[model samples]
Target: MRTSPPEPLAAALVEGRTSSLKEPLLRDGRLLWLEQRPQEQGRTTLMLRPAGGDTAVELTPSPHNLRSRVHEYGGGVYAVGGNDLVFVDDSDRCLWHLNLPGAPRRLTTPGPRAFADGLIDGPRRRWLGVMEAEGRDQLVAVPLAGGEPQRLHQPADFCGYAALSPDGRQLAWVEWQQPFMPWQRSQLWLAAVKQDGALEGARPVAGARPVAVAGSGPNATDAETDTYTDTSAISVFQPLWISPTELVVASDASGWWNLQRLDTASGAWQPLLPLEAEFAMPQWVYGMRTTAWDGQQLIAAAAREGAWQLGRVHLTPDRVGTPAAWEPLEQPFDDLAGLSAEAGTLVALASNPTSLEGLLELDLTTGSWRHSPAAPCPLQPEAISQPEPLWFAGHGGVRTHAWFYPPAGGAHAEAPLLVKGHSGPTAMARRGLSLGIQFWTSRGWSVVDVNYGGSTGFGRAYRERLDGQWGVVDVADCAAAAQALVAAGKASAARIAIEGGSAGGFTALAALCFTDVFRAGASRYGVTDPSALASESHRFEARYLDGLIGPWPEARATYEARSPLAHADQIRCPVVFFQGLDDQVVPPEQTERMAAALEANGIPVEVHRFAGEGHGFRSGSVRIQVLEATEAFFRRHFQR
Candidate 1:
């Protein structure tokens, strides 16, 4: 029997006229969100859908770019209260105020400062948020009527997720110091709000506490041990004030990020609806919400077994410590975020295997929902390849997860495999519809999105699999995923290739150097030198290597051993690199050096550098070019 060749999907169908939706907010029956327009040079604009209206309208016009750069990968850019909207303008990194039916006004003076994760304090007539300036982060208050910003608190090196009590008497927020990412360790803080809007008696109420230790340093004698303390390892996320004295937060002390109620008076942490599922995600950006209170029940999003679902917990305040009733809502989406609930309404950014990300609105009373898609998907349902969850034996013979996407039409005999390592090294490869994956599958390619050991959506123990073993663990898992497909007769062993961006790029390069499964690879702004990343990376990840690869100078040998550039000669197949010249995270120099090393070893290597781009490619033209070039390179090298 003979089969016809599959049709190739055009690159324009994947990149053109596509918008990314984020940060959905529901206020007074109104829906607001941020839409990143790729056709508009990746400018994110504010969008609003009026109450009882079907059509949504754009609020911030061109050149506004409603965004924040507080931690570079900014989230929590805009906040709304009644008729007032406060946002951090990307152009000037200043806070801007917008009153309904009026022009936007600049509230903060222009400087190096940037604000995010803000909320309007109606009672005080101020906007309170985390401000980043001169590499220092502090909780600040800026007058809504326009004035100099006031510093409210600087409890740690970073702070965000500020929530003012309903009575406006107390405030709660999450903060963390260096050497650890927010997901690894963070503190939940509580403070009294003074009449003058200053914080009084602020202290940590939840999260890991660092206790002093003697002789904790590597190579330290007894004399130097007492000065060192182990870094905190518990993470607390999104403190929401249900009342003036009671609040709920997600803490990972139970090995999973679960809901916990913190009583302000006694500083007691009470477990709420204890479950094995995760109720929080990594705080890579600000303004992330997974749980919300809608005046009656607690609406939450939980990740279980690599997929996300919406659930509600009925709280019984009188019966303390009584397990709440957990009801999982039947929804179409598997990936959810930006959850906001108020006045019997719930809004979130959601997507499933057949849908692109969109603003999802649910009526708590009726249990009905509506979706506003970010963009019209170009491909038909039949052309989209759905992800089939696969559990394979990975490094150390432990079970690892991946999503397998066969050819669009159906499974193809001996199809070429494209293994993808998702960025973050801490991020998950969700079961969502991705046009990019469809682009290849439509051309008869099999794709596997590997959720390697360190990827989230799993428990904390699974996420720590890459601790001090970033390159080794990620590389092994990706190779094992591809090999699993080969063993199952789903992919051709000789034609498998791998690709990734940022941290995932590191995984791809490391796989190429250390494993024999992948014949070619593509890396976008990938890290080739762990030592360089440790010393020259930004402040947010300055101490990231302390956990991923061990403390900097102390583990210099391990860094050199794991670097792909140092082992580029071992890569026998062709490789292509895409890098943004202005990328601050993984600089272009790293790509240049790796390409040079591969070229010297007589390996076919191509380096494509884009200007006016940052860590990620935002321009549609660049995105199209990257896809075309990568496809061409893979086709030319894949063994038939």
Candidate 2:
């Protein structure tokens, strides 16, 4: 009997005609969002859907990229108030304002300054946000009428997440200093806004110091001590004002990011729905909202055991001491973000394992919801591969999580495996239906998206596992995940490969050098040398290595020992590298040096360099090329 191979998923299904949506905002019964169109040469434009209209209209014309480069990984690019909209123009990196039926006018004189996390001060006729200039960040106010931006405050080395209280009398923002990422150690500060828009009486409201308890630390082993200290500082997330004298925020003081309310006048914190779930995510970019007030109650999205769910909390000033009444909403989405609520309407970007990312709208009054996908799924439901949650023993026997996708419509007894390490090193491997993952599965390749020990969506202790052990912990976990699949007799032990981009790329390269689990590997703009990254990185990530590996020059030997480029001879597998010439985060030199070293060692190597591409490939054609090249390279190597 002759058996035929399964049909492969099209490359265009993963790259072409698909647009990404971000920073979804609901204002004045209108839905506004930024759409990154890959087919249009990766230009991001503003989209507006009228109050009751089904079609969305483009507001920003050609070449007007509504992007911010403040931290290189920019977000919170646009803000709206009534009819006025403010955004950062990527071409000039300057702030621009656009009112309906009028052309956008430049607000600030472009120089080395870049702005993000913007908020409109309609009453004061000014725009407020974080401004980065000369390697320092400060809260600045740019007048809508045109002039120099006023420096409102420089509380620390970095500052963002600016929020104004109701009645416009008080200002609230989050701040953190060097050597600490915002998710690791950040403070919530509040100040009075003067009649002239100057800040006064600025004082820390929360996240000032570490949370300690009597007789026990979070990981206490000593019994003799009367008091124990926890060294990790409390990290604060998005602050939203619920009343004139009260505001709500998420703080990781209880080992999880739980919602809490603060009374400004009395300096007291009240617990709101203190569950063992995270109400916030890592602050990689600006303007990340996990909780929103819907005029009657607090609507929040929380992560529990690697999946997300939406819930509501009922609390008021009179019920301060009582437990909050929590109500969970039954929805199909497992991943959610960019939540915005107004007048009993809730909108967010959401997706599940069987669907693409879409704009989800929920009517609180009627308890009904509707989903509008960013793009239609090109494949049928039966062709999709569902993710099965897998828990494997990771580095040092610690339990780790991952999503395993079996080969779809294939009769192979032992399928080849592709292990993926997600970027951010702090990021999680979500259970969304990624067409990229499906492209391999539909072609009879099993896949595992490993959420390493240091990944988020878990408690703080789990996330800190990679602290000072970036290359070692991540590499071990990825290898363990692949080995687990092989042990289960579902995948071939000799035909497994690993691939990652950015930090994930570093993991894949390091695994090839230090472990023999993978037969081949691929890296996209990966960090081959941590020492080089410490010296050549941008301002936002200058001190990021302090926690990841250690201080740069002080731990110089550790950096060199763990770098993949420093030990390229140890890698015995054929490798392929993809790089962007203009990547400021992980420069092209990192890829060039590693590829050169592998070639010198007589190992099979392929390098693809895109001239205008930066850290991430945005053009549809380039994405298609990368996908096809990677598949061809893997096939060629696996056969040998």
Candidate 3:
């Protein structure tokens, strides 16, 4: 009787076949899956069987240390290297360890090119949070039960994700400095471990600063005790440590990020749960970063009521005032793709846009849930094709958010429309389900996934409505949501074509240099120079293009007048790119100088690189050779 979910895939931008989930790891009882198949060349590989077995086991066939980054997820054992980090008994002198399979051993040494995320398993010790490439700073330790890694207490700007204490004693982290961003304000700290193990001095339980209660005499004290401290405290982010001294972290104080709890030796605090939504963030620094405990309860991974799941908090030790309820136990994710909670099961590796992320478990003492293995696809679920949810109205009157898939087994009498451009121009193009937008809506062709305007679960004022309005209203709200879904009949205005990658390939080269609602486009590893991402990025955003465009030699002529490679003679249509020739973040010469200026302006361009992929494109054979060469270049430009 509830059969009204199919009408939503209407003007789906460009979903020829998409479905990308994530890493989620468990091991032994089995629940590992990392399928990409980006057509086959951008392949990812890693599948184990068990939970509900159908007998899958590719354990990693030809993984050049898995690209596109997913550093760590399970500290029980999981550490991958980069630029030489071999391990099975010190073969490459081990720089990072724990990928089991043969017990490699060795965790850190050989500093210099850093960047890792996903590690924190305290109690026999193991923390790893490094980030220095001038990594804006956050280098904690216990990198491997050894020594030399402890450096917390650093909030004048960015002090990595620490989290410890299931009995490791105490150490919840999150600090921020220099021009904000950790959601604008952070300073969570909390350390205390002495029984001979050190680290007993940290500060800020969640930003505070007013200490000066003196009253001595022999030391001439109590002049207000010459004390005042308040560093403007503000805290926010996945902090964990659920009990030992109590801690749960993730804050917005209460505007969203949720979770909260503090007590480190009693500056005392609480809220262990309490949500309107938003439970955690910061993916890939190593991967897991916080959430996944079992002592009493702590599950986290959120985005509430608008999808993305896995939330559950129960901590019941000497019960205090409100520990926040929050229930929802996973389900509603067109793409959660990875997660691995503990204390008796809770896996999840979802995906739906078109399918390819399977693996689910749940069970934490009968909350009951199963779903395991049912996500591998090259096509077939009736050839897939199903992603719908359009919303619209954007342009500040608000109401935006997109996801549409149409193409599966329908022949379309004339099919053609593939507008995408999504790479977080602020990130958002979620409704989950997508196997490359069901390989372009199964086969008929049509897919649109724009959550344009600085996306992030519709809040903080429609996510700063694209802040200074990057590339003019995110390329006119992705060409007015593809001309309001082909004037509402759902696509086919002479068939559209637009694709994206990094920053949705900079809004598909700024919607082919300022809109006409896409005629032809594609950009993987995008960004056609925002003053060269503010003279080369990495400092965790080095002023993130001064808030997306401005403050760079004074907006140097509005970043070369909103650069689309500075208007390659006002593009005519026909472009193709897929780079990663080791992308230093949108650098393959920014797509070979925009494919030699759109192949000398006659338009019809092409690029393709992949050597070791960098900005994005981590083999599965170059994501199925960039999804079969962008579906044979949109079927040779829609059959001409």
Superposed on all Cα atoms, the candidates' RMSDs to the truth, in angstroms, are 4.6, 6.2, 22.3
Sort every candidate by TM-score, greatest first: 1, 2, 3
Q: Candidate 2, which ten residues in sequence have the lowest lDDT sum? A: 212-221
How do all models score by TM-score?
0.95, 0.95, 0.33
Q: Alpha carbon lDDT of residue 420, candidate 3? A: 80
Which pairs of residues collide in candidate 2? none
Candidate 1 lDDT, tens digit per residue, 45-68?
Answer: 998889889788888997898888
For candidate 3, give the lDDT: 0.59
The Cα RMSD of model 1 versus the native structure comes to 4.6
Backbone clash tally (model 2): 0
Clashes of 3: 79
Q: Which ten residues in a row have the lowest lDDT in candidate 1?
A: 212-221
Q: Give candidate 2 regions above 4 Å deviation.
A: 1-6, 209-232, 316-320, 410-413
